[model samples]
Target: MKYLIILSLIIGLSCSERTLLEDYVFDDNDISVVKHEILSSTVNQGYTLHKLNLTSLKWFNELLTNRPIWWHHVYVSVPDNLDSTRPIFYYIDDGRNNETESPSETAKLLSEFSTKCKCITVIQRQIPNQPIIFTADPKSKLRIEDDIIASTFGLFFFNRTLFPNNTYNNVPLLFPMTKAVKRGFDETVKFLKSKNVNFTEKFVVSGASKRGWTSWLITAVDQRVIATMPIVFDLLNWQKNLHIQFKSLGGGYTYATYDYFLVGLTAKLDTKEIREILKLVDPLFYLEKYSGRKFLLFSATEDQFFLPENTKAWWQDLSIQTNNQIYIKRLANVDHYLNQQSKLQIVSDIKVFMDLMHKETSSTRTLPILKWYFENNILFGATRIKLSNLGEFDSYTVTSYSAKTKDKTKIDFRVNYLLDKSFVDSNISWIEAPLIQSKKSDLAAVNEHVYRKLRILSIFNYVGFYLDVNLKLKDSNETLSISTDLNIIPEYYPIGDCYNEECLGKLV
Candidate 1:
C-alpha cells in the first residue's frame, strides 16, 4: 500500500509538471510587430488607391518561422470634391481563392451616399499555408484543412511544421485569422497616418458572413472601430446554437459540419474545455464589451448558415442589455446570399444608421419592457416561484391568486424601478412562504395550484401596457382547473396607488 501511494504521488507530480511546462512554453512568444510596404499605386475615377502588403514574424510553440506571414491591403482615397472630414469605412474582405475585389467596386457602391469617406478594404491571405487546396468543394461538402481549420478553430491542433505551436496546444483556431486581420488593419492605419490623410476619428468596420463574424470580433477587441455592420452572420452562441444544430441534424453532424467551418477537432474535448475554447474565439462572449459602439446586424430570414431565430434572439438580448444600442434588420424570403432588394435595403439602412450616428442628439431611449412571474408547488414538498423581466422598465408588481377562492392571495411581490433581466434573489422584492401545515396530514396529498400575473410598465411608454399570467400546480400529476381566470388587465395604471375609484377612473 505504501509503494502504491508513493508511485501515485510521483505520477501526479510528473503530470502537473508537464502541464505547467506546456502552458509556459505555449505563451513563450509574444505577438510580433507587423511591417508594411506599399507595393503599387493607381488612379481611378478621380481617386488614388494604393496597394500595400504586410508581413509579421512570430513563433507558435515548436513551429519555426520559415517565412513571415503576409497580408494584402488596398486603400482608396475619397473623391477630390468630397469632404475629407468624413469617417473612413474599413471593409475586411474575405480572402477567397487569394483574390480581392476591385477597390473601384466599393467606390461605386458608396457614390450615391452623401457621406464623403475614404475606403480601405483589407484582404488577409498570409495564412501559414499558401494556396490552400480544398479537397472538397466548400459549397457542397465540409473539408478539414489547415486554412479553414485554423481560421475557424484557432491555432490549437494543426501540423506543428505549418503552425509551430509546440507549447500551447489548447489555443483556439480562430486566433491566427484574428491576429492576421488586426496586424493588417493596424499597419494600414499607420500607413494612412504617415501619408497625412485628413479623415475623421470615427472608423466603421463592415463585413459579410465569415468576414462579418470577424468584424464583430475586431470591434470587440479594437477600440478604433466606432460602428460595426455585420451581415448574414449568426450569434455563434456555442452552447445554444451548437446544441440546436447537433439535435436538428439528427445528432450526426457536429462542429465538423461543412457549414460550421469544420471545428470538429473539439469533439474529443470535454464540455468545460470546449467552452473555454469557444470563450477564446466565439464573438458572442465578447459582445458585452461593445457597450458604446453602434451595431447594425443584417440577417436574412432564411439564412442557410445561421438560423434566423437565433439571430433574432441574440439581437433581442443585445437590445435589452445594451439599452437599444444595437439595431437589427431582417429581410423576408431571402437566404444567405441576400437578393438585390435586400442588398439595396441594407445600403439604405446603413446610410440612415450612419446619419443617426453623425447627429449630435442623444439617441438613448427607454426600451419596451416585459416582466413575468411564475409560482408553483411541483417539487418534492417544496414550492418554487420565479420572477423575470426583459427590457428597460421602471417598476413591476406580481400578484398571485388562489384558484379555489378566486381572490387575491397574500403573495403580493413588488419591486422598485430597475433595468435587468433576472429577478432571482432581487434585493428590492420580497418572497413570502406559505404557513406550515400540521404533521398529521400527508404533505403529498396537500397539492394546490397557484396562478400569477405580472404587471409591468415602462418609464416612458404609457399607451402600451404589458401583462403576463401563468398557472401552475404544486404537483405535476394534479390537473389544473379549467375555470382559472387567466385574463390580465392591460389598462394603463398610474405609478402610485390606484385602489380608489377616483384614482382608477383616472387610468386610461
Candidate 2:
C-alpha cells in the first residue's frame, strides 16, 4: 500500500511540471509587432481607372487638373494574433496629402477609436482621387507638392472644377472623388482578401468634413465594411447655412474652386430631378438599402446648417426601415470639431460596438438576440438571448400592436414574433413563470414562441424597462396594460432610441 501511494504521488508531480512547461512555451505568433512601411514604387505604379468610361469622371478630373497624374497611397501593417483581429486603420483625409508623422497627430488619430478595443496602430498616406497609374507625363512632379501645383492647380485648373455650387442638394462645393476612392478601397479589400484577412470581423472607415462625404461614398459602394463613422457630411451646405468660417485653400486647391467643382457634379436641372437623383447620391438613400448593416452618424447639436432636425429625420427613417440597426449620435456641447472629451466618448462607443461585432462573428448561423426591454419598471436587459437552434439567423420576424383599452382606460401593446417565416411555438418555462403569477420578469431564455411575440415593443428608453403598467378595474379584478403611445419622446435615450435591437422596451 505504501509503495503504491508513493508511486502515484511521484507521477502527479511529474505531470504538473510538464503542464507548467507547456503553458510557459512562447510561440512566435504570440507577439504582435507594429510596423509602418513606405513602399519603394510610386503608389499608383500600374493602377487604372476602368470605371470612369463615363465622360463625367474624365471631365471632372480634367476640371480639377488637365495634366496626367499618378496616385500615392500608404500601407500600414500590424502583426496578427492580437486580442482582437483589429484592422490597422488608415485614414486618407479628403483626397489630400498623407504626410503626417507627428506623434501628437498619431495619438490624436488613435484616440478617435475606442480605448477598450484591442488595436495596434497603423497609418497609410495616400493621395486622394487621382488616377492610379505611372504614365509618362513630362510635366508631372515626383513629390506631393509638385503634383498639386503643376498638375492639378496650374495645368487643369481643378481649383475651378472642384468647387461647390452652394445650392441645397446641388453639386457639392467639393467634388465627389468617387472613382479614385473606389479604386483605393477595392485594392485594399483585394489585398486583405489575399492575406485571408476578414474585415467582417472588425473594420471602421471614418472622415471629417469633405472626407466625411468621402466616407459616405465609400460605404455606399462597399458592403464588406462593418461600421462607418461619417462626421459632418455635406459640409458645403452646412457651412453656407450656418455662416460658419471656412478654410481658404484645402490641401491643393483654393476653397472657391473646390466649391465650384462640387456644384457641377451634383447639379440637376430642377428640384424634381435633383430629388430623384439625390436618392442615389444621398447617404440616406444607400443607408436604406443596407438592411442589416450598422451605421453611426455623429453630428453636432448646435451645428447651424446640419440641423438637428435633419439628423433626426435620417434617424427616424433608418429606425422605421431597418428594424433597429442604425444609430445617430448627437454631441450636444461641442460644435463640428469634437472636444477632447467628445473624442474620448467617440472612441469608447466605437470600441463597444466593435466588441459586440466580434462576439457575433464567432458563428454566422446564430446571433444572440439582444433584448433591451422593460420588466416591472425596474428596467432589465440582456445582450444575448438564445433561441431554438432551428429557427435562427435571417429567419426572424417582428409584429407590433398598439391600442387604448376601454375597461379602466389603459393602453395595450404587443408584438408577434416569427421564425423562418413561421410562428415559433417553443417553451417559455423560465420567462413565463414571472409573467404568469407575477407581473414582471428578466429571464434571458423564453419559449421560441414567446420571443417571437415579444420582438416588436421597442420604446427608446435606456433603462431597459420592458413594461409600462396602468391599473385598470375589469369586472372585480385589477389588470395591467402596456403602451408606447406617449405624449413626448425623450430628447435622448440609450440604445439610440433607435429601432435597432437597442434601448429599453416600453410597457405603455
Candidate 3:
C-alpha cells in the first residue's frame, strides 16, 4: 500500500509538470514582436483611430506543412477624454484582415463606439491567422472558424486517421490564437505608452462568436481582464452542451456544427481524451478558480449553432460562481447571424453595462439586485411570476407588463413611460406549445402556414423562453437588460435521462 501511494504521488507530480493550455496561451517569455507598424491614423468625433499591423508569434513548431507564425492588423480607437480610472473596453473581433477592406471603412463604427462611450476601444483581427493547410491522411484547407479549431484539436488527439503524419504532435491551435490576442494588446499598450498615453491596465474583454469563446477563456487565465462580455457563444460546460444539443435535437447534431462533426471531433465527444482536454480548455472548469469575475452572457434565442435549452443546464453554476454578478441577454427571433437591430441592441445594451462597471470600479455603485419565482395562478390554470425584489430595479413599474396582464393583476406601472416611450417592440413568432414561449406579445405572428416550417423545426426541436427585467440607471438614459435563466421543462426535453449511453448521465 505504501509503494502504491508513493508511485501515485510521483505520477501526479509528473502530470502536473506538463505545460497547461493556459501556459501556452501567453507563451511570451521568449517571443517578441516581429513587426508592428502604424499604417494610418484618423481623428473622428473625439476619437483617434489608429490602424496598426502587428506580427506576434511563431507557434508550436509546424503543423505538417503550414507555417507556425501569425499576425493581425489591429484597430485601436482612443477616446479623447480617456478616463484613467475606468477599465478599457477592449473588443476582440474576427473578420477578414486589412487586405479585405479599406482601413478607414473598417475602423469607422468602432471609432464611433469609442467616441460615444468615451472609452478606449481595441479590435484585433486575423486571430487564428487562417487559410491554413494541414496535410494528413487527406489534405484539408481550413479557413472557417470551427474548421480551424477542430483540426488543431485533432492534432491534440493525434487522431491518426485524420492527421496521418501527426508531425506537429499535440500542440493546440487555440493557444496560439489566444497568445495572439494577448500579444496584440501588449503591443497596443507599448504603442500607446510610446506615444505618451497612459490608462488603466484593466480591461472589459468582449467578442462575438468564436472570439466570444476566446473571451471566456481569456478571463480564465488573464486576471487583467476584469470583466467579460461573451456574445452569441453560450458554450460553457461543453460536455453537457454536446450531450444536450444532441439530445434536444432528437439525438442528432445541428447542421451549424458541421466543422466539428466533419473532423470526427464529435465522434470523440464521449472519450477520456476529450475529458482531459476539457480540464485544459473548457471555460467553466476555470470559473471557480477565478471567482467574482463579472460576466455578461449575450445570447440569441434562435442561434443556429446553440439551442436555447443549453443555458438552463449551466446557468445556476455560473450565477453562483460570479455571486449573481453575471447577467444574460437573449435577443428574440434572431439566428446566429444577428440582424442589424440586434447588432445595435447589443452595443446599446453593452454600453449600459460598461457604465455600470465604470461606476463600480470607483466604488460609486454596485450591480443591481433582482429576484423572481413562479407561483400557481389559480384563475388562469397556469404559472405566474412574482418578483422578489422588484423595488431594486430603478424603473420596473407595473406598466412594463402587457395590457392583458395589467387587467389580470392590479399593478400601476409603465415600461414605456418609466424608460423611453419609443421602445422598439420585437416581432414574436409564438406557435404556443409545451415549453416554448411563455409570454404574450402584442404583435403575435401566428400564421402557421407562413411560420409552419420554423415551428415544425424550431418549436418542436428547440425552446428558449425566459422573462427579462429592464432597469434604468439612477440618472442615465441607458437601460439595463438582465434576463432570468431560461425556463426548463423536464418533459420538453429529457433533462434527467442519459439517453446516449456514451453520455453516462453527464446531463446537469
Candidate 4:
C-alpha cells in the first residue's frame, strides 16, 4: 500500500486512538527520489554548506494547482567529524520559492552546534511550495508560513470550496509538508551516499511555527527522529489549547491568530470533525511512542498567538513523563520570534542542550536533572523547584514573569507593546529570582517568591508567575534551561458549561 496517496488519506483514518498518528504512512512514490542534486557547496564558519535541490514527488496532481511537482531547497552542513554513527540535526523551515536562497541563517546557529555536537545538520525550506496562487482564481494567492496553514485548515477542516471549479475537497496541506521533510532526509542520505558520505540515520529535528507543528507530527510517525525541539509552536493538546486561548485572551484569541479566525476555523473548533482532526495532529496522542526520545518543549513568554499558561494543559497529561526527557525552555520578555533587542535570548543555549543530546548515548557529557520539592502540597502542586547535580554546574539563576494583573480574577500578559523590545527593556523585566536552601537535602531550590504553601481548596492568584530555571555547564559559557509549570489560575467560562478548569484541565 505504498502507492501515492492524497491528503484526504487522513479522512480514512478517523478512529479515536493513538493509532491516529501511529498508523499514518507515506506512499513510497510520495517520498521517492525523483531527483536530488547539489546546486552549490561552500565552506563557511568551518562547516561545509551544500545547497541542494530536491524534487521529491508529484504530491497532488490536477487537484489544488497545476504545479504538483514538489520542489525543495535543502542545505546540508558537514561538521568537522562526520561519522555514520553520530546523530544528525534536521531543521524543518518554511520559505518562498522566489526568496533569496542563502544558507547564512542556518549557519549562524548550527555552526557552533555542529562544532559541539560534531554532527551533520540539514535545513529544508519551501515547505508548502510558497507564494502559491489558487488554481481557480489566479489572484487568490497564499504566502509562506501560518497564513498558508490557516487557508489549508479552511479547505480540509471545514471542507470549504475556495476554488469552485475543482472537484477536489478536503485535500490536507499537512500530508505533503511532512512528506517534504521525510523525502528531504531520504534524498540527503542518497546524495551523501553518492559522495561516499556517511550518516547515522538517526535525526534530531527542530522547527518553528507551522514547521514546528510539522516537526511534532513528523516525529509522531517517523521513528527516525529520536529527539525533537519544537520551537514557539506550543499549542499542543490542540482542542484544549485552542479553547484556553479564548479563556486566556478574554473570550477571544489574539489578533495574531487571525489566520485561524479568517478561515472560520475558530467556528468549527467545537465540531466533531475538528476534534477528530486534533487527534491526528496533536502531539499528545503520540506520547507513548516518545518513551525513549528526548524532547524540548520550547516556548516564548511574550508569544502573541499562544499563551505561556497553555503548557499546563498537556504537561501533566504526559503519562510518559518518567519514560522520556521533556524540558520546558522558556525565554522571558520575548515574543513569538524568541528574539528581542539583542537581548541574551535563551535559544542561544539550545546548542548546548542539543550537544548534550548527542552525548547522552555516546559521550560522558550527561544532561542535567530537575526535581519537584513536594513538601505537603503534592496534590495542590509542588511548592518549590529543585535542580539536582549541583556539583556539575558552574553557576545557575532563575527568573520569572507574572501573568497576574491588578484584578486577581484576570491574567493578561499579552500587552500591545510585546513587539517593542525597548518597551520590555524599560517596563517589564524578568528580574532575577532569589534561590533559597531547599527543605530537602542535596537539592538546589529555584523559586521566585519566598515559598507559599497551598492549602487544600485554597485559591491563589488568578494566574501566578512562572519560573525559568537556568543552569550553566561546568567550566563553559553554555547553559540549559527548564521552566516550572505555568501558574494558570483557571477560571470558569461565563457562557459555557465548563467548570473547575485546572491549569492542566482537559476538555477533550
Candidate 5:
C-alpha cells in the first residue's frame, strides 16, 4: 500500500518531471539543460573565463523525483595563440561551506593552472533549506537507512531486469555530490560546444583534500576522465586506518559523523560488512578495475588527516597491483594545506604527467615504480610480516595450513610498522619487523625466538588491548615492542555512541 502511494505520487508528477526522473534514474545519461545563463565573464592572463549560472534537475529516486539543483560553472578557454586541440582539465571546487557567492580559494588556484591548460571548474551553490543528498546525517528526517534502501533498489532496477544473487549496494557515500558535480561538468561541456569552443576529449580530473576524494570517484565512474590526480587523500583501507585513528585521536578524528562517512553506511554494519559495502565506491576497487588509466597520488608526509604510513602502504599495495601505472609523490615537511613551494612542485608535477599522457596513445603507459619487498613469518599470536626496500626489492606472500584439515588459507597482512634502519643499526633492536594478521586460531608460537603477550585493559570505563612482544632477530639481538588497540563494542554501546560530547562522556 505504501509502495502504491509512492508509485502514484511519482506518476502524478508532470510529464517533464517524469521525463527528468526517468532519464536520471533509468539512463546513465548526463544532465540535460533546463536553463543556462552566463552570469559573468573576464579576460585574465591570455584566456577568457566565463562564470555560468545553471539550473538543473536530476532524479534522486522514487521518493524524490525531478530534484532541482543549481551549480556555478567556471569555464576557461585556451589562449588565442595556443592551439584549441589542448586537453581539458576539470576541477571540482571545495567551497568549504564559506564561499556562498564565489568560488573558493582552491578554485582560483585551479584557474592559475587554466592559464596554461584549458580548465573547467564546477562548484555547487549552497541553497538554503536544501535537502541533504550526499550525507546520511543521523539527524536527517529521510535517514541513512532509507537512502541506502532507495539507492540499492534504484541501482538494481537500472542495471538488471532480474534480481541477481547479490545486489551492488556499495554505492559511494558522496554519490550525490560527485554525480551533481559530474552533471555540472557535462552541462559546461555542452555549453562550450554550443559556443563553438574547440577542445579535445582528453579530460584530466584533479582536486584537493575532500575535493580530491571526489576526483577519485569521478574518474572511477566516468570513462570520459582520462587521468586523475588527487592531493592529500589516501585510499580507503578503513578497517586498519579507521581503527588506528580511533585509538590515537578518539572517535572524532575519523570523521565518522560526517554525512559522507562511508555515506553513513558504517553506522549499522560491522567492520567486515562495512568494507563489503564500501567496495562499491572505494577508490581501491575502481583503481584496480580500471588499471589502464593514469593515476597520480600526491600526498604530504606530515598530513594530519591522512597518516603518512597509511599513505605509503596504500601506494605500495597499488604499485604492486597496478604494475606501476600509479605514480605517487610524498612531499617531506608539508602538511595537507601545502605551502607555496609544495604547491609549485605540485603544479609542475601535474604539467609533467599531463604532458607525458598527451604524448602517449595507449592506455597502458609505464611509470616509475617503487621497489620494495616483503617477508612473512609465523608468530605466536600473530603473523609478523616484514617489508623492506633499502634500494632493493624483497617481498613475499604468506599462506597458512590448518593443522587438522591442512587446507591452505592465505593470511591477510596489515603493516604495523616500517622501522627506520638507523634505529635498528644502533645496537638497538635487529632487523625491522612488522606485525601482520593471520587466520584466527588458538595462540601458538611458530618461532622459538618470538614471544607474545596480550592483555585486556579497562573494559568498563575504557576498552583497550595491550600487546607486548619480545623477539630475537637473525643477528641474535633482542628487542621489546609494545602496541595498543582501542575500540568500543557496538552491541554494548549503540553504534554512534561516541559521536557527541554527551554520549562520549557517558562512555567514561
Candidate 6:
C-alpha cells in the first residue's frame, strides 16, 4: 500500500523543462551502463532495507569525462518487516571504480562478533589518480550515493578537488562539497518522505577518513541527522596543502564536488562575490548551526596526517556550541587505519551507540559470525598497525596474504594467539625489509633488536587488509609474540529501559 502511494506521488511530481532524470541520464545507454565489476549485498532492518555496490574504473572514467553516466551499482539492504521500526546503517565508498574482493580474517572476525541488530558492510574499489582537478581539466568526478536514496540514514560519497593540482592530496576538506552533497542528500530525503518513508526518528551519518570529513560536513549542513561517526577523520586546508605539495598555486579554474563543476566567484566573478560565497561554503565559519546534532568521532591518536589537536578543537567547539551531547573516543596508539582489535571495537561501539539512540533491543542470544567481505584494492593513510601496549617498539613483520581485489592484498597470520605483553621474547629472529606496494615485500629484517619486543604489524593499502605476521621461534632463547584478531558478534543490552525516544526533541 505504501509503495503504491509512493509510486503515485512520484508520478505526480511536476517535471521541470529538464527533469533531473533526463538531466543526468540521456537514454538507454545511460541506464545500460556497465563497469569492470559490480558487487552487492542485502540486509534487513525493521523499517528499511540496506544494500551495497562496488563499481569499476570504466564507470569512473565515463563520469570524469563529462559523459552521461549511471552509477555503477546499488546496494539495497532494506527491512524485511516493514511495520517494525529500526534504524538503518548505510556505507559507501569513494574513488575510481574497481570491483575486487579479498578474504579478510580481521573484517570477518569483527562481523562475526558484531551485534545482530546492527549491520557492518562496505562497497569499495580501487580509485586511481585520487580524482584530480587541474587547470587543464577542472571537473569533479565524485558520485553521490544514488543507490540507497530511499534510506533514512543517507551515507553518500563526498569527493572534492580542493587542491586541484595535487593529485596525491586525497585528504578531504569540509568547505565546498558540503553544500553540493547536502543539496543532493536533502533532495533524496525529500523523495523518501514523499514515499511515506518514516524518517522522523533518529538519523546517523558516518564515513571513514576522507569520507569521514564528508560525514562531518553533512551533519553540520543538515541538523536533521541525530548522530554522526567519522572514523579516522581527516580534514585540512586542501588548497594550502595542494600549494605546498605541488609547489604552485592551489585549486584551479573552478571548484568541484565529486565529478561536477560548481562556479566559483574567485575565477568567474568578482572578489566581493567570492567573499559573499565564502560565508556560506566555509564549514568552520558555519559551525554554530550544527548545535543540535550529536557526534561520535573515532580516530587513532597516532595518526599523523590528521592532527589530534585539530580534531580536538573541532570536537570541543561542537560540544560547547551544541545543545546535544558529544562523544569523543580516541583510540590510544593506533594509526589512521585501526588494527584488527580496534576495528572490532569501532563496530561494537558504533552499534551500541546507535542501538541506544534508536531504542532497539540488543539480544543476549548468540549470533552467527558475519564475514564482512569488502573488495576495493585501495589503501588510504598509513598501512602500519600500531598496538596500544607496544608503542615503545616499532614492531614489524613479514605477514603473507592474497589480493582481495586488483587494488588490494589479503594478509592472514594464520596464528592462534592472543596479544599479551608476556609473549615478547628474545628468540624471535627479525629483519626489517623495505615495504612494497604491488608485490610481496622483502622478508629480511634489518633491525634484529626490534623483533624481540615486537609482536605484529599488518601492512595495508587502502581497499582493505593486505598482510599478516607470523612469529616462529627456532631456538629456546627466542620468545613467541602474541597475535589477536577482531570478531563481529551480537551484543546484549537491556531493552525498554527508557521511553525517552524523544530525547532529541528535549535537547531542542
Instruction: For residues 358-456, write the lDDT of model 3, one tens digit per residue.
Output: 766444345665443333122221123333322223443211111111221111111111113233222324222222222222112220110111122
TM-score of each: 0.55, 0.44, 0.77, 0.79, 0.56, 0.41
Worst 10 residues of 4 by lDDT: 499-508
Cα lDDT, model 5, residue 222: 66
Flag regions of model 1 displaced more than 4 Å.
Answer: 1-33, 56-68, 81-85, 96-130, 133-147, 150-171, 247-256, 259-270, 361-508
lDDT of 6 by residue, 1-508 (tens): 9999998787666321332222222222222332322232334223232222322212223333332232322232233333225443433235443334442443333233323434422222111213333222444433333111101011112223432443212122222223323333333344345446553333466667655766665665454565677787634333222222111111221111112112221221223432332333234444654565656667554453443334323444555766324554555446566787777666666655554455422432111111111122222212233222111122334332221111112111111111242221112111233332211232222221111111122122111122233222222222112211111011111111111221111000
Give the candidates in order of TM-score, highest first: 4, 3, 5, 1, 2, 6
Q: Name model 3 segments beyond 4 Å from true.
A: 1-19, 33-35, 62-65, 97-99, 103-107, 135-142, 160-170, 361-365, 372-393, 397-464, 488-508
Clashes of each: 14, 40, 3, 1, 5, 55
Q: Which stretches of candidate 4 lie over 4 Å from their true place?
A: 1-25, 31-33, 104-107, 137-139, 158-170, 319-324, 340-348, 361-365, 373-382, 389-395, 406-410, 415-429, 436-463, 489-508
* Top of the candidates by lDDT: 4
lDDT of 1 at 28: 23
lDDT of 4 by residue, 1-508 (tens): 4343643465445432345334333556444546888899878765787889988667566556655777888888887666567778888877777777765454456644565567888888888787765466456665556676676666665454544544223255666677778878788888877877777888889888778888987887787988888888878887787666656544555667666677666676677757666655667766665656777877777676677777767776552553426777776667776554312343465567766665564534366666443234434433466555454566677665554432433344554422222322213334445553223233343323333424332254343456667677677876676777655444343223222232222111
Off by over 4 Å in 5: 1-35, 56-70, 96-100, 118-173, 244-273, 363-367, 370-508
Which runs in model 6 stand beyond 4 Å of their true positions? 1-72, 79-83, 98-115, 118-202, 234-282, 359-508
The Cα RMSD of model 1 versus the native structure comes to 20.1
* Candidate 1 lDDT score relative to the true structure: 0.45
Error of 5 at 211 (Å): 1.7
Best by TM-score: 4
Looking at model 3, residue 371 earns an lDDT score of: 42
- Candidate 2 residue spans exceeding 4 A from truth: 1-92, 95-108, 111-116, 119-176, 189-202, 234-270, 361-508
309-384, model 2: which lDDT tens digit per residue? 3432344455565555555444533455567776655555555445445555534522222222222222322222
